[model samples]
Target: MASTRQIITDLRAQARALDGRHLSGSMMDGVCRSLRRGADELDRLLGELAMLRAFAEIPGDAE
Candidate 1:
């Protein structure tokens, strides 16, 4: 699976590319909205990943 950071980066790039090119009602508008949602989701996932890693490193933590 792709790392959360990388997934966010890809979504940001897609959003940038779609910026300023969509009309009021077009497919690109939907694409842009989806990309924004994807980026937000990835950010949340990254936070979860960090918490998991920190929990794993607790002293006396089990495998």
Candidate 2:
């Protein structure tokens, strides 16, 4: 699986491409919106994964 940071980075790149001149204004708007949504979702997933990892490791922690 790609890391959350990697996913977000890729999404940003996609957004940049959408903003480039080849895309029409309306199409660029749609693509940027979709990419933003994807980035948000990826961030949520990463947070959840971090919580789960912490939960799983708590029992063995000595401090």
Candidate 3:
């Protein structure tokens, strides 16, 4: 299981739960959107970092 996928899934679940709550106000909605955006950025950065690390594993200048 990719942790990035898990993180996204968890966040989506939490957002859904918040939507179901009686106090699901605009503030909470905005916060959730911001959190999702941040998570997305982190996920993108992680993918790039993974690729960079993988490339670094190659010996010499072939990488």
Candidate 4:
């Protein structure tokens, strides 16, 4: 499985590509929509990973 950091990085790159587009109309709209979805998913995944890491770091349990 890919790490959260790598997933976020890939999503950001996709967003950049969508933003750089010179097209107009439905195609551009579709790309932007896809980019937004990817970004939101990445954000959720990163948040979950952060919570898991925090739980793992708590003192007193297995290291």
User: Which one wins on TM-score?
Assistant: 2
Taking all chains together, each candidate's TM-score versus the true structure is: 0.66, 0.68, 0.57, 0.52
Tens digits of per-residue lDDT, candidate 2, 1-63, equal: 775688899998888777644543345777787898999888888777777778887532222
Worst 10 residues of 3 by lDDT: 18-27
Ten-residue region with minimum lDDT total, candidate 1: 54-63
Better by TM-score, candidate 4 or 1: 1
Clash pairs detected, candidate 4: none
At residue 6, what lDDT does model 1 achieve?
Answer: 78
Model 2 residue 3 CA deviation in Å: 2.6
Expressed as tens digits, the lDDT of each residue in 1-63 for candidate 4 is 776567767877777777756564435656766867887887887677667878877543222
Candidate 3, superposed: residue stretches over 4 Å from native: 1-5, 20-27, 58-63
Over the stretch 1-63, how does candidate 1's per-residue lDDT look in tens digits? 775677788998998899768566664867888898999987987677668878777542222
**Model 3 residue pairs with clashes:** none
**What digit string (tens of lDDT, one per residue) describes model 3 on residues 1-63?**
457667777877777666534563445676577667877887788777677777877433231
Better of 3 and 4 by TM-score: 3
Backbone clashes under 3 angstroms, per model = 0, 0, 0, 0
lDDT of 1 at 5: 73
